[model samples]
Target: MTNQLVPTSGSPERGIIVPVPHQRPEHFDAETQERLNRVDDAAFEAIAEGRPENTVTAYGQDWAAWEKFCAETSVPVLGVTPGTLVWFVEWLWEQPGKKAGTYTAPSTIARRVTGVTVSARVDHKVKLEEGVARPARARLTQLKNELAKTRETRGRGKAPALKIPHLQLISAALPDNLRGIRDRALMLIHFSIAGREHELAWLRNRHITRTDEGLVVDVAVSKNHPRIVGIPYGTRLATCPVRNWDAWKTAVEELTGEPVDPDEFAFRRIHAKGKSLMAGGITPEAVGDVITRCGEIAGLDIRLTGHSPRRGFATEAVKKGKEREAKRQGGWSKTSRAFEEYVEEAGIFEENALHGIGL
Candidate 1:
């Protein structure tokens, strides 16, 4: 028999006819609909901001590189088969670096395939299969090993980790003035917290609390996540984070002739003449600038970045047998490879096999 359309309420003509699977539209109140719309906006925003901006931008560039390859090679952009993926990587490995004779760095090569896979799904709405992931990673590893043995390390690599001695030198080199006080507090607090640049940049006066021991800081452990960290009193008053912070706060109050509002920035830019404070807070990049200035003043050889304090904290903590505390304080996830690297650096000379044979 031929199939027939079924009518609602068993009426042949009154109700509309429907196919095999019938459906109906539903309505919600205006307030409920508005809330649903907000939920959608928030969900997407969260996904977008979930990763750090640099990672997102790097992946976007990686995807663009894949697109460029596909265009030149006449491969289908969406048709990312295992063979195509492997071919794309092989093609990437042959590309030139910024230098005349240098090839693409292994780190860049490592991220390309993963970036392409992510871009395929997130940008093009295609879910490439997982069939080639293992092979791709294996081949990438082999290429990295070969390149490591053959190539000279030429790039501006990881920033040197600052130590306590460097911190002391930086402190002494800063002038005996308002800006100097602010820089001192900033770097000391940064080290104390093992802070990310954005974390220090995000702080407000209210986030810091004065405790009997030291200051308790409320910080975002991740995007929109809050955690309280304790910064204890230091061995001496000169290099103490808490005392330095108090001095900075007092100086700012003295300059402005008004008490700092609870929501005001913990760190602010100073005037060039060193006479006044700027209206807005210093940025994340400014954190690095301050550290670099300090490094120059202290006459240190290694390049310093905002991340130096965090690196120092992790390395020193592991060196002192505070591995668990280091991870927790540094906000390093349990499986964080970067955190493990710091631990490795701290232990490279520990229980050395060649110690007994030393001169």
Candidate 2:
């Protein structure tokens, strides 16, 4: 029989139709609706909260190390047991050093363990109950406490502070070449700006602006803080950052056969033989190496790192009786504990008020 809707009054002879209730289709086109259905909102949010590139790279390395150790010991990769963590902590503590006189520092061990713990908890989704977690925590805590006690007698081997005299020596010792000019500019700018290694590495020519006063650098991002600050031309032309910067820019322009673009990296690698400049900017590691090599040339018997310039700026400011200004200029937070240490180092012998008492 042909289907027909019946009237609600049920008069069979009259063929009045009653419409059946049906859900309406969505208004979106087929392709657009399908795309919307395919989107994983949770995944998008996870991606949005992702860490920095360097941090991700380090996590990859740390996870790899943990996996390798677990594989060798025939332990569960995804379900890491409390006993496995204890053994890993032991291995971290007693791991053989790459050099004869060195072993893994306590801080390094702590970082590795932290990385592994995060990987287990987040990546593997390992959830431990109180019974396992309590003992695991106890073991790790005991190990860390023991390590700290053993290291109590040792000194913190920080990078040696570079002063103006040291800078002058290092600058003078550089060979008179393209590399020399570049290094000179890098050193002077690093010392003057008091910027961290990554900030220096990421600098573009566009970030610098020249005014009647001097050159100002806009640090787009720094360690924990970012801002704009001016670094003025020094009275001592020999070690002036602005002069060195101009000389470097001129040299680069001559080599490239064009004016340097604003977006171009401020610093680039030089060929070891000093024949030509490399295409891209130098790494933070290379920046640290430059300071170390310069220190060797200047006959500084202490180890130097990338932090030397930033620390040097603070120390110099302290010595010049500009502690407050130095703290502000160096981008240190108001609650920073490091201010006292730099101040003490600056005034230990020369600027101390107690020296007049002559005890």
Best by lDDT: 1
> What CA RMSD would you report for each candidate?
8.3, 10.4
Question: What are the per-residue Cα lDDT tens digits for candidate 1 across 54-91?
Answer: 45766888888888889989999887778777777778
The TM-score of candidate 1 is: 0.70
Task: Single out the weakest 10-residue window by summed lDDT for candidate 1.
Answer: 17-26
Q: Local distance difference test, per candidate?
A: 0.80, 0.75
Stretches off by above 4 angstroms in model 1 are 1-46, 49-120, 131-140, 221-226, 271-274, 348-350, 353-358
The TM-scores of all predictions, comma-separated, are 0.70, 0.74
List candidate 2 segments past 4 Å from native: 1-50, 72-75, 79-89, 96-100, 117-156, 350-354, 357-359
lDDT of 2 by residue, 1-359 (tens): 24456755566667766555543446678887667645644444465356554455556777786787778777777656667777766666566555565655555555666667666655554554345434555776787687678864112346678789888888888876898888888888888877778778878899978788888998775656677878888887768889888889999999989989898889888988897988888887788877777788778877778889988988988889987777667788876777678878988889667876978
- lDDT, residue 289, model 1: 86
